[model samples]
Target: MNVNEITPFIGLELSDASYEDLVRPEVWEQLVQGVQERELVVVRGIELTPQQQIDLAARLGEPVPFLISKYRHPEFEQIMISSNEMKDEKPIGVARVGNFWHQDSSFVADPAPYTMLHGVNVPGTSGHTKFANAADVYDRMPEEWKAKLSDRIGLHTVGKRLRIRQEHVGLSVAEFKALIDIEHPKVEHPVVCKDEYTGREYVYGSREYMDSVLGFDPNENEAFFTMLDGLIHDETHVYTHKWTPNDLVIWKTRTTYHIATEVEPGASRTVHRVSIETRRP
Candidate 1:
């Protein structure tokens, strides 16, 4: 296998390997190490069937099934790759999912440690995914800032993103929440949390998922979160990935936050996504 560093802190791209090679202990070790060190790792030319994808995910950790029924694959409930490509003048899959910057399932009590996406139909002109190294951002923060956030916690909720998505999809918040079996009450996580595997600390939630910072005046809370958003998303700390067919991306949720960059309306950009539980870490 050949490895290329996409960015200093954010991403790694591995080539010259096939899907069959991934199950090997050595190759799987490399995949795990890549995700641990790089936060986001993308391997090219590994086309996976739904079962193959699920099998690969299981190798890393327990697979978290997609809770949203609209996005779930009809044949395989574990895979959820939605696209704007129409079938009979209606959308077959969800579009612009995770367009906002966030760590997957961070609003929940126990969030997933990793998110894996297998590229199926990548749009030619657009549809890039940008990742930020939250750990790196936290490391560069000033001592004063770190001290202020040392004991701070932020409120996170699915309702935050739900509101934005509902505006575009035309579903009421109650209707939207009712469609998914996942329970997303407002939850709080430390502003900076330590990664169990690496023992390194990273800023946890994002503006998209976090409703507010706890124990601060409203103005102070907004300012702090605004500052956090600016620092964590600064271009220097980010890496943008351009996708190719059969490119599988695995990203560590504890160390990074990611966003789906734009694609044209109705353009096809399908990817099968699954989550690995943080419990093993």
Candidate 2:
């Protein structure tokens, strides 16, 4: 296998490995190591069926289904479908999700430590996923800020963002409310988290789900988020992955924040996602 760095710190691209080679224990171990150290790994030019993809995710960790029930694959609960396609005038999958910066399942008590996406159908003109290395962001933070936020906890919920997504998909207010009524547990995590595997500290909250930092007033929390946004967006800490059909991208969730760029209107983009559950450190 050949490995190339996509950026100085954020992404690694692994190529020249066949499906047979990838399923080997030693090769999978090296890929996991690459993800832990580089934050993201893109395996290029490999083909796999849906079952094969889920099997690969299982090798990494327990494959977990997404919370959104409607978007999950009908046959395989472990896979979530993100697409712009429709069947019989109904969306086949969730459209335009992850357009904002956030971590997957951050509001849950046991968040996924790894997230993998297979680009099944990609638009030629656009459709790129951008990632920011939160570990690097924490390292570059001001000492005073670090000291203040080191032990603080962040309150996270799917609150308003759920409403936003509901509107995007044209769901009625009543339907939207019913989904939120299902009693999602309140979640809180350290603003600065230490990765159990690598012992690296990273910023753990994003603007979407993180309502506030515990013990901080609204103004202070807002200021903190604003500062974090700037640092995460800094060119040195960011990597943009242009999607191609059959590209399998995986990233260490605790160490990075990601967003999907807008695709051209009427463009078709379908991606299948699998997330592996891991307990919080």
Candidate 3:
């Protein structure tokens, strides 16, 4: 895999990525639009535990303190998703199986730019996460709809939005509700986020979990959430992932939306997740 010999994946525009060891330089010269050093390359082989995952993420960049959950792993609480296993051991905000989708650390002042997940002892057919192509969603937005949302920001509160699951998964009722009052700016970044290296901008956030869009009236919560959510729910613009043991997926966090696919009882799936905070933010 020579750094100069990179080629595009069928559906993906691989112009920005160069394999460090790839030797076929001619294969990649034609498609690459631009190249910004890739921050990560998924490594497969030895099973990765929480700490092991942290170590690998360290190679790409320093861990940006896991910001989503109140609980922290002594060294690092890299985002992780586990099913059937006791939820307390991992940093999943919503454990068990469910249909919830969200961005990492959006509620916090700074969110991560990338995330890495390594699957271990995965179940036969459970716990695969689906990542929607934010870019596709943004392109489909009607120009008027885009203008309406262009400058808005949304308030996201973990405890307020997913209370029951928070409690069931081990968060204390009192602690979970406390977060609802926190409001986050509903930033309308470029609808399509061009990869700094690939020049491909992807839609990274959604309205379904939005608390408010800048000036949206609080009393009209339903109208606001519904109006924008309907746009994202149109279903033609999303990607769902099914996990495989030893499989690793690293993604551009700033421009993607992901959700945990629940595992049925008597079945189990576990994953270790790590996130990198952008130096710019």
Candidate 4:
């Protein structure tokens, strides 16, 4: 297989390989290693049916079950469908699942370490997946900023995400938060986290999930977190992928953050998402 770099810090696109080759143990191991080394892996020119996608994802890692009931595939509970197409006056799949910067499952105490997306149908113009390397961002931080974040912990919340998502779709955040407290008060995680696999440190903060930072007053927390967000999104540390059909991409959750861009209205983009059950270090 041939590998191409999209950016110096983040993406490596693998080509000249088939789906059959990807499922092999040796290729899978190499793919995993590539993802760890580059933070993001994109394999092109492979197509898979829904069942094939599910089975293949299982070979790579445990496919975490879909939390959103409405988005679950009819046959596979572990596969979540993201699409804008409709059938018989009803939505065929979930659209705009994640519009903000986040690492999948970051709101939980044990966040998933890997997230994979298999592109079934993607728009050529828009619908890009943007990635940010937190490790590199942290490495480039000013000394004082690094020192300030050394002892700080971030308060993350799932409820806030649900609230924001509901609000985005024209629902009341308060009503959604009251009906279900799936994500309770909040969870505390260190601002600076060490990746167990790479032995590298990264600034781990999500603007969508982080409620506040401990040891800092409200204003200070806001300012600091905002600055950190800017750093994480800095162009030098970011890579945006314009997906093609049958492309499969995976990113390490602990060392990177990603967000989905808006697709054109009336356009459909569908992907089967899989998240590894292994906990982030």
For each candidate, the alpha-carbon lDDT, in order, equals 0.81, 0.85, 0.51, 0.80
Report the Cα lDDT for candidate 1: 0.81
Q: Can you give the lDDT of residue 226 in candidate 4?
A: 78
TM-score of each: 0.89, 0.90, 0.65, 0.90
lDDT of 3 by residue, 162-253 (tens): 53533346656564455444333333433334566656544445554445556657755566455546655555544545555665556666
C-alpha RMSD between model 3 and the true structure: 6.7
Q: Clashes in each model (backbone N, CA, C under 3 Å)?
A: 0, 0, 19, 0
Backbone clash pairs in model 4 (N, Cα, C under 3 Å; residues 3+ apart or in different chains), count:
0
The superposed Cα distance between candidate 3 and the true structure at residue 275, in angstroms, equals: 2.1
User: Predictions ranked by lDDT, top down?
Assistant: 2, 1, 4, 3
Which 10-residue window in model 2 sums to the lowest lDDT? 159-168
Q: Give lDDT tens digits, candidate 4, residues 1-281.
A: 89788788888888878878888898888888888888889998588777777776676567878887778888888878888877788776788678888877677787777788888889988898889888888888889889988978988886656635544465475756655454365778899988777788887777788888888898988888678778877876788888888898888887878889999887888888877775324
Best by lDDT: 2
Question: Which of the predicted structures, 1 or 4, would earn the higher TM-score when compared with the native?
Answer: 4
Give the least accurate 10-residue stretch of model 4, judged by summed lDDT: 162-171
Model 4's alpha-carbon lDDT is 0.80
Identify the runs in model 4 with alpha carbons over 4 angstroms from their true place.
163-183, 279-281
Order the numbered candidates by TM-score, best leading: 4, 2, 1, 3
